[model samples]
Target: MVRKCSVAGCNNTAGLHSFPADLKIRRQWLHALGLEDREFPPRAGVCKLHFTRDCFSNAMQVEMGFSSQLMLKSDAVPYANVTPPARTPRPQRRPGASTSSACIQLPLSRDVSCQTDPLETHTVGTQLSLKTLLPHFRSEGVQANVSCKDFGVGMSNADPLGLSSTPVKRPRLDLDEQLEDDALEHSSLEEALKGQDSTHDPASLDSSLKSADSSTPTHNSKKYIVYESCIMELFNVCPVCTRACDVRTQRLGTFLSVKQWCPRCTFTRHWNSQPVIGSVPSGNLHLSAAVYLSGASFILIEKVFKAMKLQLFRYETFQRHARAFIEPAVIHHWKATQDVNLQSLSQEEKVIVGGDMRADSPAHSAKYGSYATMDLRTNTVVDIQLVQSNEVGGSCHMEKEGLKRSLALLESRGINLDCIVTDRHPQVQKFLRERNITHYYDVWHMAKGISKKLEAISKQKDCEKLKKWMKSIINHIYWTAASSTSEPERIAKWTTILNHVRDVHTHEDPLYPKCEHVIRKTTDKSKWLQADTLAFYKLEKLLTKKRTLKDVAKLSPHHQTSSLEAFRAVILRFAPKNVVFPFIGMLCRLYLAAMHYNENVDRPLAETEEGVPLFKISFPKSRKEECRVKPQKTQPTFGYVADTMDLIFEKVFVNPVPYTDALLAIPVPEDLSP
Candidate 1:
């Protein structure tokens, strides 16, 4: 007999007590009936159907040091009127009955289909309650005291159902015992299949299965490196001669290469690109590329190699690489400028040109002098000529024939220069004047020469006050040329400085007759400028000096070679006075520098919406009264080199061999040495 369920509509037996011991599984039964608490004194229980699947899972929940008591669900109808069957006691077994005793002590594992509570921690059996049989279960070495903590969480991996977590005591196996156990297992399986499978022998089948198991290996999932299968062979044909097939090779730096070759060739003419001992290129080892890329000084590169125990090439090799790679990169950029700046030649039928020359060193002795001619409208070098030794056969003139050569080259290119501005080099002035072309002395150069003279005068004890006006005098030379329209006006504005420095503000010319800048109305002692003083008389004599008058009379009204000076500085970086090279090598370096300088000569350093180039004010620290120096915008080198490298790799570089002058079609420079 069984007690009826406490659930309102359920008539099944109350197998489970609807345990709400920890309230994990009790919420559903409580919510279904609107109740606060439940008590089990009345044995108000319900069947397992009311519990969720989670409550019936194999994992058992046991609170430490506490028994799990259960009570009926509130929604369960009262079963107080029903009576459960009376509990029965088991009959005692006979003494010395080992088999029957063992049966009674063993733990039973049963599924939930038997209407038993699978959630119960105790094992179930037929004819007795597990709690009453606990003593007998312990006699068989079953772990009655062990709880969930004793079994540990990993118990489920070994036995998911956790029905047999106890460690049973057993005798250790000897060699004979091991053989007996294995024979017993095999015999039992053979006996069952003994009467079946009459066509096959078990012994032969067993041997075949053993062999298959031994041959097949299990695979595991993991990441690993896979080496290449084999080296590629040119094969069948010999490397020295296509007629022969057999050849011997040796390994070189992980790759295969020919050790010996036929007498016809000098070096090893045969090699395999593949490695005999396979490996991958793992890191950056391009020393030459890294040297230029990081902008590290060559000495520092050598030091780094020494520190890292890496092999550094000879110093000449680094220089050769510079000529090989960087020089061409710069030339490529220059040629691009030539194409894009073609509009520069469209400014006039014959554009105003400014010519200048740079020597290896400024002295009596020089190995080379490079003259560059620039079109005034476009601030870019039209062409350059390199003169070795003394220019123009060591002629008795302060001029470089390199200019004449460069100008001639430009004329052949259909570029006609209307007028040229340069310092009064005797031959340069004579050459232009003889051609009947207008020649204007570069105003800045004239001003520099005058300032040098003024600086010497300012150093005199009585003329120390003239130092303050040195900058003004230099400024006045530029101001006069910039302010005057005619050559006569240029002379008038320039000569006015003698009267102006003596406090004579008024002038003869209509354009700049009166001083434009505000005058100081102070009565300081140094401000007491008078024409009768020694400083004034000395400055007057220097201002009206023969060289000064000659330069000012032909002052360039609106042109100067200030841009060329900036380009020469770039050339100095590329060619560098401290380094020496062959004559052709020197010229190529100059071409590289010219291309780089011309590319961004007019680009605004930082611009506004109006697109005018910006100016920066700088005070010269060296010169107590230095002339104003104009600023050139910095050209960005980022990506410029990379683009040039692409041009070299794609268009210029044909092979691993060094570049040749014959390939580029460059003419050798003339030797002017006596």
Candidate 2:
């Protein structure tokens, strides 16, 4: 088999020869070739590159200088010039002989003696002068490996038998070792530099090299592990002051559930608390802002945070903790705002108050309903209450109990009401009467009631024109209320509709006897105002009802709950009906809506670049199948609800309450507790 050359980095193998049979000499030659601690295959040998011109015995070793085509002999050796260490064996003795009868071999004392008596003038080998011997050694071109650091003045001056000029012989490097180091040698003409004696064992050299090769991965593996993901030890030591422990804590850890502190400095920081790649998202406040405040779905939060490489608990955990943290705080803030709203209310003696209830679903089958009272003067939610069928002795309905509680909350807050406007729900009227609070019907509600009657009448063949006059009648009711202030003036203005519907805009009312708005000459008001007698009688029929007349008696255009309706719209966005929330969650969401509305209620919803008000066309949805679609322009406002929610989190959740609840029981969800 053609194995790679044992010499370091040398691949040539032609005419290879087994290295020194003595292991120590073999390692010395290997070290001289600069292949120290290199592992080679079994019985590996040197190529001819290490030998001089006269050392090889074959044409192949002489020509290609390698044993690439031939297997090396196991007993073959290099370095014919260097002699092995020589020692004579001990003479054998008979086992039975004691010292008295023992046979011992003895030799003449002069036979192997190197020492000659000082008085002797001649020696057996023939005494040679130093001058004669020194010339022979100098002409031999011998070299020895002598390093300068170990050289001393005695080495330069001292010579045995006065042979100071004699050349020293260096042990021959194996052909393999010389070629292995040949690349390191500058050129073929350059003599090899002598190397220090190698104490390394050829038998154990493989293990040491293997260990060195493996050490890199071992050290890197100690610092980090690669399983499903990388786990690096990080940030365990306190950066502020860890010098005393730095020797031991040279590498801080980066991983989950890690809270570290310096014993000496008391500096501390924390990592994941759940011992996983993902845990509570302690540092990302923006998640709360987007999820709870901005009404972003939790699934979206998960996708987004995961994309950003933010380690976070699952959305389910977020759902639990977020609701728990935000609900109570929102309620607390909602109550606090009541105080502020009431303080602002102190300036007015009698504030126009409008209370309305918005169900989670429509009125028939609502799981939850929130009733809120707003200050018409300030357009702020003063108080609100949420209810379910189970609450308040199982009323099995939303508006009655919810409105009662909302009113009771406002009353407890010492809010004074001038008049209340609401839909013509029988329960609401009864609630108002029981409390002896003044009640004015919502004009839109009354107008809706009149329009329902008009739809009934317009279906009759005699009252077909009532469909055209129907819009005029609705507009007339609001116009009359806005155009007149007191009961009699409102009465007189509303009565003018009988003549005005028959094309008599010139009326009997003192405050509004004639049309208050401009009358165009291109088209006569009389032409459009000339109401059919049948339509006139039809409108008059519905308009003359006692409830209808009573609503006009307390006409309050300013008391219309459009702002409350706007609040309801905002609440729908926050607590969307399709998404059922727990009782506390629903209430808190409502509170969040109320807080957002109150803060920016006065600001126009939209403005042009020139600061002029901009508006959107919105048509009212009505019960009439073929009603005129009169789209009205309404200004828009900036939604700062999410931004405000961020503030609430920073201020309120910064030091959160241990528990969050109001009248309802708020249970900690199982996921969050874990």
Candidate 3:
């Protein structure tokens, strides 16, 4: 049956709103219609003509074509131009002739008022009884037959006072209750409909519907690797007719669409395995993002997919996605996070940071160099600058250029640097000196350099004894930097390593006159280098080299850049040197690596249920088969990936112009080829 407005004179059947179950709001609505004193039908509703436009929640959306329906606000009440219909006057009684036998008939369209006592007589026109009117009411689909004896009114079954002692049938007033039950039963269908828009394309509509489905409280969103055969089984049979269906399947990369039609019942359905954004499926975009963000090689992933006969998008498609959405998201999120970190550091009086440059390739053949500057206090990467080799004129000069850009950015952001620790790069030293910034050399970089030189000398025929003290010499470099507070003390302590390696343990310098270790007799007599021998002479010359000593004097007394080195290793995972990338692609990958590193830098060591720290044993190539025990860190979280995904789908995908503009503002260097 069609629904009409609850107001008595109005017969409009469109744009109606149901009566709210809330008694207070319902009373207000009834009062507005001048029916507050009567028992209105529960199924009655008010049309939109009786409500003002401001009462709708989506009035603007509907007007602007963004929405096709008008949704009323929860507290809305109809109050516009509503008037109650005038009641018809009752006919005069015939001088009260047998009034006790008279009966009243109420119209089905109007409210009916019933009395508590069934034996009471209601008079209208003639001397008509309720028993005579009951047959007509039953014929009109109104169940109102009642017997006075059934109500315990002391009436006899022998038709006393013309009343019968039969069962009563009351009118149903459960229309609103049944509607509520139906709404509850089909709530999921309502949710699905709410996500659809007639104005959107099928792909976007699918995306919206999928998003809505995943947002439901019962939905547990997870990704699974499904095979084609497994999916085909679901559409092989028709759900309506329980017969075979003509199923047509289409595959685009990781996206699948199935169309099924049943010949018997003419039932059909078109289903999409995953939502899409524009022509690109969400799975395809997400897969590209996951590989890039996690530093996994797409080619390797493609191989895995091929091995399993799984369809995947091409490399060009992945590149397209990266250039359009993934890269911009990475850049946007990194800059946002970096600003927060720098702002926090700017509040401090003195900020000490470690700076380092990592090349895309080893030696001078590198095409890209990324300089990462980290706040030593927190061990979090504060900034990253990617420099193309051609932009700096050559690969060798990219380090200085990257450093210049990073320091310039930090300075503009008001980061007051007390000092910076870095590898002993001559250009970096000169640049910092020119700027009057205090610069210290990382002890590890200096030790690694000295160890390489000593290792080379130990391989010589006459200087073979230097091999015995190589480890001790490297350890002394770290001890000297850690123990000494001044440059003179550091140099003094470092020179004593020469004496300690030989039979002598005393030094001529007053700052460090003797070895700190307890005096003990040597177990291996041939291990100690004798004074004036060729091996001792070579070792002494290398140790006291003028430049080496100069580097030693500036060894960092506090924080080191080992964390920065680890971040470079992370960069390898995202943008490896073996695979070439464009300027923006490389830069974005660097940002992704930095984000990953900063998020997990402070992860605590993994521990067992008994609170014992865990460790992993690895045989590094450099260790020559000797196993090194390293602390096992707790599993890292990919919250940044989730955040970036949200940014891409919710913000960037909605309006990509701004993110693309921000990306385009960066000065990309010309291609090196031409």
Q: Which digits, one per residue and each the tens of the lDDT, describe model 2 over residues 142-244?
A: 2332211111101111221112243323211112222212233223212221111122222322221111223321111222222212221333333333222
Candidate whose lDDT is highest: 3
lDDT measured at residue 115 in model 2 versus the true structure, 0 to 100: 29
Q: Residue 398 lDDT in model 2?
A: 68
lDDT of 3 by residue, 1-674 (tens): 77798787789888788988888988888887788646587578888788765576544323322223466777888874753432334335445334442223232232111111232342211112334322222211112232221211112223322212332132111111211122332352222222222233332322342442135211114567777667667667644335676665555567665545444433344455665444445677778888887778899999998998877877877887788888888899998998899899889999999999988889888888888899999999998888888887899898899889888988898888999999999999999999999999998888888889999999999888888798889888999999999998988898887778777878889888877789999788898888879998888898898998899899999999988988888888888788988889888888888888888998999999999999999998766789999999999988898888877766676577889999999999888889
Per-residue error for 381 in candidate 3, Å, reads 0.8
Q: State candidate 3's TM-score.
A: 0.68
lDDT of 1 by residue, 1-674 (tens): 46766666678773555435556445555555444455333455656555532233221211110112222333333232233422224446546433332121221333242233323242110111223322233222121222221111111122222123342122111111111123332353222112122233322322221111133211111212222122223332323223333333332111222212222111112222221100110011124434543344567668876786443455654565556555555555655566555455744587888888887876856677788888777787877777766435543332457767866666665665777888778888778777787888888777777788888887887888888887778888888888878877777788888877777789877756888778777566575357787888888888787777777878888779988888898887667787775675677667666666665666657665697766676676546565565654755553544565444443333332333443255555566543
lDDT-superior candidate, 1 or 3: 3
Compare candidates 1 and 2 on TM-score and give the better one. 2
Name model 3 segments beyond 4 Å from true. 1-220, 237-244, 277-279
TM-score of each: 0.52, 0.52, 0.68
lDDT of 2 at 144: 35
Backbone atom clashes (below 3 Å) for every candidate: 3, 22, 0
